[model samples]
Target: MSQEGWEASSMVSLAAWLEKHKEQLIATAVQQLSDREPLRQHAAGPVRWFFDSLITAIKDNQQERLETILRHWVSMCRIPIDGEPVGLLPVLGVFKRALWARLQANPPDENPLEFAVQLDTVIGQAAEFLSKVEAAALLDEMSHRLTAQAQTSAALANSTKDHFVSVAAHELKTPLTVIEGYSNMLKMELPEATNPRAALMVQGIESGISRLRGLIEDLIDVSLIEMSLLNLELQPVWLRRLLDIAAFEAGDTVKQRKLILDVKRDTFPAQPIIGDPERLLQAIQKILANAIKYTPDGGRIAVAAREINKFIDITITDSGIGIAPENLDRIFEKFSVVGDLGLHSSGKTKFKGGGAGLGLVIAKGIVEAHGGTIWAASPGYDEEQCPGSAFHMMLPLRDVKSGEGMAPAVATAIGSLANAVLERDSVEKSPQKATSEAPAESEQKETPLPVPVVPSKNDHNKDQTKKGGTEGGEKS
Candidate 1:
């Protein structure tokens, strides 16, 4: 077949694959780029549109159109304020890569390499040609990228960071335990100490400990999420109970805002969803935390969870600085910061809220791990013109069916755990639901860890005396 003819057929194949599985393609590409840098806070719609245009350019067999599309894409690519250049080449290459991958999956009648070669030539030309045009915008980005490449180390070195953090956090546990024990001892020993400063100082230390503990937990959770070590103890849970817990947690955040629960208690259904309630609660709290950070003081935050069809729809709408439409999709990606300056991971800057940028990412990971889905929406970026933002998390109310909810492996992992819980419930007839209170102190164990006995001075003395007596008896 002629080169032109091959390109035409290849375009058709690519379009078919995209139509059937664009999300999968995008997901594959995103996962490849995720660890390297933050994702652009744009929805997948723009991404799909670009892929469609590339397909059209190929079908038309027009060099001018292809260059035009490629140039526009370079211009639209948002650079980080720090000018850390994103791998522009790798991102642009995703177009060709997706086509090549799909072709290999089905082995087109025409040799797939022919299409791949043609794509490679154009993508290469676009990268070299457009780099000059966009270099000014990418100067800082490219410089930083070069520095990173130069300093790149082994894979183990990359993971050493999380491991070190985990170790440091563990080390803190011993000291924290001691502090709690000593502080309690002081409080009990001096119920009315004359020096009031002693009490105030202890109060301050306790407060700092609480904050440090929270930070440590967040760091540990991040490592767990990254390693896929965060296990879900799955059970049948009521969706409302999880949402309520999330709302209550949000109320504790340092925000002067009103939380509105939109669901009518009388009409709300017991959304009997199979999930790890603790993981689900954490995910919901992360989403609400984002809302708190983005919304300004005196903002109105509305939260609701209702049963829709077979899924529980939990919606959080905030009357604060609305997200830019392009940024709505990016918020869930790890290490990404777009839209209003005050994102969940924004640092201690006065204007933007402080964060580690892991909240939504962890939330996404947790929700997906639980066989649920999460997404965001906004009118625009302008607070006055934009009517604020809303985040929706959809969780199944029944046992997730095959071919519909989660990918088979994720569903299987979580579903198997849920099944175990259900089976245990059937056998034991347990009464623990989402809202059940903890068992009484009499019913619960006092400690989870085994206490080690230390030998006292008196015990050592007794042993020595017994040894001496035995020696005397032997001599006699």
Candidate 2:
């Protein structure tokens, strides 16, 4: 067959297929319209209405009505077919011209039925292409919107965190200064008080002040960490001595809580290690304090240190409130505390007493700043077995001999400053007896006398007139 004859036959076959499936196509349109899901249902109403009108036009053999209905359908469906609607009139004209040419070459007159069938086939293909384009464009728009929303949300979260840090810093500074001042005053003034009540009151005041100071310091550390301004004062220092001091200072609280604190010193080095002593002590204190705070009154907290090859490993293990498996990774995050894991380890909430949830955050920061690593481990939560949490801190070690040159100076400076502050406070509070060689306290209190002045003639006359008038009856 000739190429033109083959093309004509293919168009006739497509037109016949459309005619046979027209009812099925209309049902699909109705299904799409009545469906509840938005994407699927978007095409349903316009498709059904267009098909109903097309069926009416076909029955009436109204070509203009069929063209108008197809155009209205494309516009109402909002389907994109090659950037614009494939207007039914242009497509129908093409089919009409092709059919007329075919008829002229073959039979005496054109077949109108065959021409209508070809036009329907062309319109169907155009509608399918438009639907697919519309779906793709909708999906692309949704993806862009979702990505923009996620970025906006993340930006808002970071901004809120920054604002909180700024406000918390200013709020904490004033209270911290007042607490430190009163603690200094009490330490100086009540060193030798004999009364038990006075001693107890002083101890309570000091303890309260210390707790307040710790809270403020934690806030400051958090703010510093958030701002990325945490600076470490690195130097060589004896791990054993540092641990001993921390243990001693923390002992008071442990004893008051009636909790057992076992410090295992076998693993520590006899000589100093090179690192920031103050930050190391703060990190250790944070861990120990957490253990003491969360553990029950009778629970035990063990602090063990070991020197392993090139690192010093310190572990604080407590049979306190253990973490859930899901929460383990989040425990070290800022403002994160151990949530209830169904097992009442201490019979109290982990951070309800006196925690802003910044201890672990600061602890982790200090350990990392010192070129060390820290992690928390728990054996899950089980009520039958005592659930516990363990915090491990590992610091890289330096040769004791190499670090010896700088250790003494750092230790001396730290000790001397501590002693000087103590001594100055003592001198200010101690009462001194008055001595003859010393200036009299009364002389210090004396007020300067007013200078005498000669009275003017008018003032003297006024003073004499009052005296003379009273004395007139007696002196006359």
Candidate 3:
């Protein structure tokens, strides 16, 4: 048929055709909704309503209402299909073409169904395409949200673990320290003849207690570091004196390992500086202890401090197993042991230690807390040459202001604080006398209270030797 003839004929049949098609469309939509898919059921009511609205608009010849209803119907039809519809594609295509032909007929201006069918055909395809794009975007958004939630959950778990370790360490440290302190007192108060085995047994007990105490302290420090709560109590502390105290405390360990302890007094200033003495000493002790532990017997370990402009540079260099270049940067990380150092078992480098691998981590944390910097340097591992490791700590020196005194909350114990002050004085007078032997037994007897013989390096080694020094160091 000719285009003009078809247009005129379609116009005459349009009203009747749309009336029949509307019924068919309603029937098909109802049938589709009867399927198991919930989306189809949801779309069915709206689809039937649109068809009814279109039919009413066409009957009344309301052009605007017909256009609006057709547009809405096409938009509704765009809903994505989850499963196959009851009717086949060919049947659906024929109905769609018929609907389009009625719209293309361009009925009289008064005809309300004028552009409805054409609008539905074009709008339906566009809406369907847009719906697919929106669905894809929503899926991507959901996926990203899930990934972020998982990462947040993992981080929270790690934080909880760290908190648990910290709390456990703090709870365990106080009793262990008290046990060790009392054991030391017992050994000193009792005479060898009173119970020869008494002194030996107390020494053994003291050694174990000390090691456990050290491990607990390390864990607490690491926990504080992780939480960013490590703060320093700065006061007037004699830098040289603190070094001597650290050296004294570490003397037994050094001697046990047979490492040469070369402490150069000239390198540090004699004047008192502003800092946290106990925390500083602890930091120094941890570094020295690690050096002593790793270095072979007869190795050379030097503790030297030199003054630079406004800072005191304390360096501990040891002839021990040096760290690899790649692992140096990560050494200060929490529970991070240097890989390729062969320090851990299984020939793999890991932070697998007795007390949670917290020594180095705590030392670094304390140093940083004090506004100081601590770092390790090594020449790498060389079995033939006996590679060396060096730890350097730098602290700024500020003049002590008048009226500044130690805070009441800063001291760990009254007796220890007093002892620390006296020990500092002893070191200042003469460095050699500081490391000298204890008074003779006759002199100790002069005092009614028996003076204790503090355990020496030999005493500590006696236990290690019995256990076989080759055994890996025990953590808490």
lDDT of 3 by residue, 1-476 (tens): 01121233333444455666665566565454445557757656766675566556545545556445544444343433455433223223534554555445534354455446444533354344434544565577689999999999989998898878878888887777688778868978886779788888887897677667656766767777888887655555565665666677667766765668898867777655656656677678778767776666788889888888788889999887787888787877777655433444431111122234566777888878767898889889764576988999988777543313334443323335446556667775787876888778885453221111112223433333223211222121
For each candidate, give its TM-score against the true structure: 0.48, 0.53, 0.50
Instruction: List per-prediction Cα lDDT, in the order shown.
Output: 0.60, 0.60, 0.61
Give lDDT: candidate 2, residue 127: 50
Best by TM-score: 2
RMSD of each: 22.8, 23.5, 15.1
TM-score-best of 1 and 2: 2
Residue 392 of candidate 2: its Cα lDDT? 93
lDDT tens per residue, model 2, 265-319: 6667665566655667778888887787767667889988777878888999998
For residue 407, model 3's alpha carbon misses the true position, in angstroms, by: 5.7
Winner by TM-score between candidate 3 and candidate 2: 2
Model 1 lDDT per residue over 136-219, tens place: 557866898887876775556657876887788778878987987888787676554675777777777777777666666767
Worst 10 residues of 1 by lDDT: 467-476
